[model samples]
Target: MSASPAVKALGWRTPLLVIIAGCTIALLNFGVRSGFGLFLEPISIANGWGREVFAFGIAIQTVLWGFGQPFAGAIADRYGSARVLAVGALLYAAGVALTAYAATPLMLNLTLGVLLGMGLAGTSFTVALAAIARMVSPERRSWALGLGTAAGSMGQFLMVPLSQGFIAAWGWQFALLLLSLFALAIIPLSSALAGKAPEGTGPKQSMGEALKEAGNQKSYWLLISGFFVCGFHVSFIQTHLPAYIVDRGLDPQTGAWALALVGLANVVGSYTAGVLGGKRSKKYLLSFIYAARAVVIAVFVMMPMTQVSVLIFAFCMGLLWLSTVPLTSGLVAQIFGPRYMATLFGIVFFSHQVGGFLGVWLGGRLFDASGSYDVVWWISTGLAIFAAIVHWPIDERPLVRVAPAAVAAE
Candidate 1:
């Protein structure tokens, strides 16, 4: 009895703990921000400004998110995610809180655009997924990434209604201030995700070498191209769909619920894609997703506008939404190993944000010009097809640059 070994207790640094913390961070980061679309009408009217002002601020945010991701990711990859996440949470909270006081478009851009964008880059998918990827075994890596993604989608689902309630109860400004508090929650949770995998582990390739290798890979660029479409589709729909629904004479609440449905369905879709990515070909699944997106968007546009149609479209689109994330990140980890996943995936994510910038800003511009979202809708459809076709040619196999001995040395 005395000789019997004591079972090991799970430490705070355990993979499970890391994943739980990371997922919670994802939830808060995505959840608090997902409902920004709901603010467009109220905020714009309050400022006596046109939609472009708000849209431009959001567009700047999108681009800044992309621009900051690579550097944030590189820092996370080299140092650790905890510090990056902590700093991001601070920026996120400050941005949201300060947004309540913004009186001009310039102020809006500074708070929402630069601060919020930078915050999201640190707390969003690339950083979280890369951390989870390194924490779990390869066999469970994809599944864990999906779990993290699903957590983020859950936030999107749950937070939109809560955000709406906040706006309904308080004014929009106070609502923003209240939500800013939620962003601060990420600070404590970031502590559990403190380990840095790249300092001494794995291949000793410099960041530049890793970038060079990925740059030479055709599949990597294909993934980037396809992900850009995902950004475009998501940003456009999330930021403006509520207005679109209102324009169609539907209740604004209908638009909110529609976005929530997308988030809810995304939980299922993201988890399923992650599990499937572990077993199936990531490229084929991606191709199918993009192709399906094109068909879904086309059908939704052609159909008459109704609350039911919008809800249905949202659900369908939600299933395809963040589902691309786990698979795409998995492919990056699969091809490159988990060493520099944050840096590599961050670069891919940058392209996505670029698309997001275009999608959101152009939606406002085009709608303002044409008095209809028709042109943007068609552009989205065409981009979906392009993404679908591009994913088909990606070589899903892992890259092998050196002999076995060299790899062992690495």
Candidate 2:
């Protein structure tokens, strides 16, 4: 088909097409990365390295991804998302493709760590949701964010099995090369998300002004702190859960299925959180999610390790997994407005990456030293409670940008 026909079908900037294309981008981007844990065992075994080697590489990728996203979001906010995503697609493909040949820890860190990290930063949820937030009206924004997040979760659910199959049918190296092809697909989908955020009628603000405005807001920092916990919880689980399962004497396939279950259940949780965010108090909802995660994690680690118990834990965890993303991002958009959603949310997301760095690195380091994930699980539980406490006091209402005189006239 000609470019014109496809563009016409996508309706270019139409809200529906934007949502559709954005979700697909999210799916492809998140799905491929979510499966990286599957390779941890095999890669370590093949290289005769410890778990820490692969874990550290992935931790680097996570931190780099976190570090790079803010700049990526700023560029998308100031210029447009398409160009950033296109470049990200190229980097992502190169990262995955080149990672196949990485025989040493240093090589893995560069290919899978730095390159993949930067690539993911460019093509990540920060950009996709920002584009969706700009394209749609406020009324639909939360739902759209939820849908996009759910699509990413769906990608995790679907891709884990496919990634496993890739490793099974071909070697892990070829499987990664196959995934690189999927990364390339993001280049085309990004076309629909082109164009800068529409500026509002308010006084023009430079990026510095925007950052300053957000910096002065206490709730913004609270969001940042809470999100850091989120990054910690998910990254630790995603990178280490499979190996954790194996260590616990379960089948390795059980770990993969558990991850798939988390993704599957998150679809419902994310969408529900999105729908509820449009109506309920977002801070309260956030408080509840973190608290609930604490309860879940506490119960999960304490429970026996069996296929049934693992699946049940996965399902429960899935419901809570990404439910936080839409709500947190929605809060950022709600408090600050959508014009700078990408940049502001990108900053909040950076905290998440910081947590991810600690989670992944700590998981490897602690386990290598102590031969247990018990301490990390306890740390995750404590952080969840801390996040719950911080979010409870956040000011969720929108800033009153209008003057008193103008407000009285209205």
Candidate 3:
């Protein structure tokens, strides 16, 4: 099929607009969600619920977010991202607003878990990056994705403190109401992503063909497996690190700042990963990132607990945190082509969220049972090593169908 004249007419400026809009959406979506950990203690205390109740709600949120991603991507791929994002914005706002009234575990799960999770699936990196991927040239795609991912980190850095402040002044429930208003901002931003998927220079393949091809690839599964470790590490730390810090006799503000530092450092890490991915071996980079994560976690666990150590850990882990995102998503695009980038990446993201579900849930359960987070920390360190090993053997070449016809002919 010939490229549309409109698609052909889209230039660098168009992609810039798309990237800006995408980054904004990512910042807001990820930013708000990242702060949920701050509310863990307060929300639990208010309802006289166990930590497990809050953890389980967030775990369900992670899982549902994972499960919803591909469908959201599929819908965006067919109908356009704007509609999906619009619906997501509404759900996000509603979920946050409704959570204020959630007095039971079941209600919290329905509001925060299902609604917010699905909302994030539509508005977060998976959908936004995919749309940006379709908008830019292949050479520029990695960098664009990195920017979007960094924007989420930026959101984390900015929003965590803001969330803390809100909770401090207005209380958690009122803070959520304020956040609900912030989520509504995505409605206007969705307009920037309002076009059909750009026609690519490569041969066209049906969505079914794309899915089947990805399913058959060993490297694809390997990527998915590695991503699971990322989800596990990140979800656990984000959800529980603040409480852990507080339990260790530090101020709650220290924990909040630590999370903020992770976000701040990750902005640089994510952007660097994106830049390097365009030129380097994404799989090797991914392997190195996982290995580094293992080392960092090991060091953090062994060192005496102190404010200095906590901040250092947060910075180091922050640098490693979400750096895998660009490399992983870029690898998918590199292997499968951007035609199905959203759906394919979403499938991979589901694996990550499965690990996330386990991570968040297990952290709560084990901590409740053993009265310490030591077990989960050690487990994360081990999983990082496992992920590093898994990523090392992934074949990073593009699929034959997506390769240039000359290369395919050879």
lDDT of each: 0.90, 0.92, 0.91
Residue range with the least summed lDDT across 10 consecutive positions in model 1: 1-10
Question: For model 3, which pairs clash?
Answer: none
Query: Which one wins by lDDT: 1 or 3?
Result: 3
Tens digits of per-residue lDDT, candidate 2, 261-321, equal: 9999999999999999998998999999999999999998999889888998899999999
Candidate 3: how many backbone clashes? 0
Candidate 3 per-residue C-alpha lDDT over 95-199 given as tens digits, one digit per residue, 9 for 90 to 100: 988998899999999998988888888876798999888876679888988899999999999999999999999999999999998899999999888766755
lDDT of 1 by residue, 1-410 (tens): 22211112224477777889989999999999899999999988998888888998999999999999999999998888999999999999999999888899999999989899998988886798888887667899999999999999999999999999989999899999999999999999999877676342454678899999999999899999999999999999999999999999999889889989999999999999999999999999999998999999999999999988999999999999999999999999998888889999999999999999999999999988888998899999999999989999898777765655786787
* lDDT score, candidate 1: 0.90
Window of ten residues with lowest summed lDDT in model 2:
1-10
Best by lDDT: 2
Error of 3 at 174 (Å): 0.2
Query: For each candidate, C-alpha RMSD in Å?
Result: 3.2, 3.8, 2.8
Estimated TM-score for each candidate: 0.95, 0.95, 0.95
